[model samples]
Structure formats: C-alpha cells, structure tokens
Target: MPSQVEVMVKALSRLLGWIYTFCWSASFYPQPIYNLRRRSTKGLAIDFAAINVLGFICYMLYAASFLYSPLIRKQYAARNPISPDPTVRFNDLAFAVHAVILSIIVYSQFWPQIWGFRVSRYQHVSWPVAGLFWGCLLAILILTVVVVTQSPDGGSDPAYWAWIDVLYGLSYEKVLITIVKYCPQAWVNYKRKSTVGWSISQILLDLAGGVLSLAQLIIDASFQDDWSGVTGNPLKFLLGNVTILFDLVFVVQHYILYKSSGDGEDDNKAPDPRTPLLPEEQALQR
Candidate 1:
C-alpha cells in the first residue's frame, strides 16, 4: 500500500503534468497565428523552422524510445509501481505531433514568397532547397536510429552503450536547437528594425509554459528524492530557462530597443497614399 504522502504527491504530479501539457501544446500555435494574421512570412527565417523540425523529430524519437526501452520501463515500474509510467504520456506524444505539424506549416509559408525574391542574393535559397536540407537531416536521423536498434548486444551489451550515448547527444542537440532557434528571427527583427509580424503574446505564453513545466519537474524531483529525473535530462531543464531568456530578449526588442524604429514610424506618421502596400498587405486588402 502506498503511503498518504506518496498518494498526495502522485495526485499533484498528475495535475502538474496536465498543466504542462496544455502549455506546451498551445505554445506552438502563436507563430502560426501570427503568420495567418499577417498573411506573410517576410521576416520569419526558414532555417530556424527547418532546424526546429529536425530537433522535434529527435525529441519525438527520444520520447518514443523511452516507451520501448526495457531499462527505462523497468526503472519506472520499480520506482512507482502503482502510478502511471512517466516516460511517455499522451501529452508528450501530443507535443511531438504538434511540433512537427507547426514546423511543416511554418516551412510551407516560405514558398511563392521565396520565389518572388529569388533574384535577390539575400533570398537566393528557395523552399525546395530548404526541403532538401530537411531531407538530409531526416536521413541522418533515420540512419542513427537504424544503427541503434541493430546493436547485436541490444540494450544489455556494453556495445549498446553507444545507443545511450547517441540519445544523450540528441538531447543535447535539442538544447543547441533551442539556443539558436530564436537567433534568425531576432536578427530579422534587428535588420528590419521591427517585430511587426511577430507575436509578443506568443512569446509570453511560451515563457509561461516553460516556467510552469520547470516548476512541475522541480516538484516531482523534490518529493521523490530522486534528482536523476533532472540530472538525467539536463537539456529539458536548460531548455525551460533558455526559452524564458530568449523570450525576454524579444520582449525588450519589441517594446524598448526598436520602439522608435521600423513600423514605429508608420504608427506615428500619417499614411503616404503614394506608398504601395506590401505584398502581404495587398493580399489581405484584396
């Protein structure tokens, strides 16, 4: 029989899991919303989305791998036999699916507009090229998975240690992806001196989700007396803080740093009737 304290902790953990799930799933919607509202992908960077898709693929694989890993499952069963398995859950799967779908949507926005800018050296890369880049990345990921699964010793063979190493490496790659994910967008905002097409609300929601997710982990680790849940996945811990950091940088850029520049001019001055609407604006007007 479980102790009263264990029961309470389990219930709290479940509740926190649901909250984290919702926040994580909802975080993917903001950029798509901004794209729809603006009807343009002008300032958004394609590489960021491309790299993000790859990172999400790795994350999905990592989560799924945990579900099948005998060692991981056994560990969970031993630790909390009465409670649900924590390795992979509906919310975790949903987060993975949401990420892939969102990445595809963001990638799709690069077309047609990219074609229009083909003559410019700055916009030389096309959607197809981006697709090719993603294809290469996908191939590499598939190859890695194949190698991991085919290990002769399987999970038990010391040779199988390579598989664990790969998983850890992939997790670290997610951290790297998170670190660089916002760079291109930030650069775009800087060069254009505006964040008009970006959604600040989305950033706020993302930050909120990240902070809550971290809190949930802290709670679980605290009550369980097993810091391995954290140390085992350092990237997840780092990801939350890193996300909040970048979001703050964006907030400052949008509100203070670029307040007097870019679209700020348009906000302050009367419209010049002679100035033609941007392609996206024209599309919306029509």
Candidate 2:
C-alpha cells in the first residue's frame, strides 16, 4: 500500500511525463511546416534531417523493446535483480514513435521532387555523414542477427542473451546520435551566418521538453527513493541534457547571433532556393 503523498507524487510525475512528451513531439513539426510554407528546404541541413530520423528509429526500438518485449524485459530484470524494469515509460515510447514519423516527414522535404519543395544546391547529406549512418544501421541489423542466432536454450544462462545488451546498445547509439546530430545544423547556421529555414519554434519547444524531461526523472527518483532509476539510466539523462544544450545553441544562433529584424533570418538574406537559376546553372542541373 502506498501513502497518499506517494500516490500524488506519482500522479505528478505522470503529468510531467505527458507534458514533456507533448513538447518534444511537437518540436518535430515546425521545421516541416516551415518548409511546406516556403516551398523550400533552403538553409536546412539534410545531414541533420537524415540522421535525426535514424536516431529516433533507434530510440523507438529501444523504448519499445524495454517496455513490451518479454525476453528483453526478463533479461533486464535478471541483470538489475532489484530494480524495476527499465525506466522506459509509455510517454517515452509515444515520443519515440511520434518522433520517427515526424522526422521522416521532415527528411522527405529535403528532396525537391518528392515533396514538391525546392532545395538549395548546397542542401545535401554529405557522403561521409550518409556513409556513417548507413554503417550504424548496418551494425544494428548485424547485431540483431547475432542476437537471434546466438539465442540459447531455455533457462540455460540469462547472461548469454545478447538481446539485452543489444537493446542497451541501441540506447547508447541514440545518445551518440544526439550528441553529434546537432553539429551539422549548427555548422550550417554558422557558415551561412543565418538561421533561416531552420525553425526556431522547434528549438524553443525542444528546450522546454528537455528541461521538463530531466525534471520529471529527478522528481520520480526522489519520490521513489531509488536513485538507480536515474543512475542506472545515464543514457536517458544524457539524451535530455544534450538535447537541451544544442537547443540552446540554436536559440542563440537564431536570436542573438543572426537576429537582425527578429524574423529568424539574416539582415542580408541568403539567396532563396526557389529562385530560378541562371540558364547555365539550369543546364548544369539538367
């Protein structure tokens, strides 16, 4: 039986979780909306979009496996022994699925013919970045095969189950992606000296989401009197903080760094991607 205070605190944590989920999920919208309205993906980094989709797909798999997969959950319990199942919650799962969908939409806008949007000549996923993501995805597939093939007989040795480690590997990969994904966008902004076409709405909402997520984790751990919920899930914590750090960088880049007339564009605007190229440039495009 739980105390009334305990019940109330748990409810509060649930509320916070939902709130952060909304914020984080909503953060995915503005960029695609901005692109749709402008009919262009100018100034947007396709590399960022490309890998963002990949990261969220990994996150979705990790969240879903820990939340729903009996085998993975059993293995997790075997390792933790005392700890409750992995801290992945319904909100986390919801956010990951929602992110995957929205990120794919945003990434599609990078293609001119696919989404009926114009893209800047410079807008492309660099071969190195593309290859890196391909390698990461290939690694994921190979590990899945290994886990499937190496699966042993019933109750032989829980330690031998590779799926648990594979799930954790997915989470760790997400953490790595979160750390690196923003670099391309930030570099693009810096090189252009502008934040145009990179929606600041997403940045502000992402910041809110990241802060609220960390707060919810802290509150949940304090109320439960189990710091393992926090310490055991360092990658989750890192995801929230790293997202906040980069969102702040984008906020600064949009507001203080490139803010001239406060429209999230530079004073001397970069040439529009939708502008008709000169005849020679069009010929080259053909």
* Candidate number with greatest TM-score: 2
Candidate 1 clashing pairs, residues 3+ apart or interchain: none
lDDT per residue for candidate 1 within 24-77, as digits (tens), equals 777778766666555555566666766778778777766665567776555444
Residue-by-residue lDDT tens digits, candidate 2, 1-286: 9999989988988998999999999988888888877788887888889898889998898888888988777876677666766677899999999999999999988777798788788877898778878878788778777767776753224577467767777877898888878999999899877787788988999999999999888887676577777765666788999999999899888889987524663323565697666456789998
| Per-residue lDDT of 130 in model 2 | 81
What lDDT would each prediction earn against the true structure? Answer: 0.66, 0.82
Q: Against the correct fold, how does model 2 do in TM-score?
A: 0.86
Number of the top-ranking candidate, with lDDT as the measure: 2
lDDT of 2: 0.82
Error of 2 at 48 (Å): 0.8
In candidate 2, the residue pairs with backbone N, CA or C atoms under 3 Å apart (3 or more residues apart, or in different chains) clash, namely none
Model 1 regions more than 4 Å off: 71-90, 113-155, 158-162, 260-286
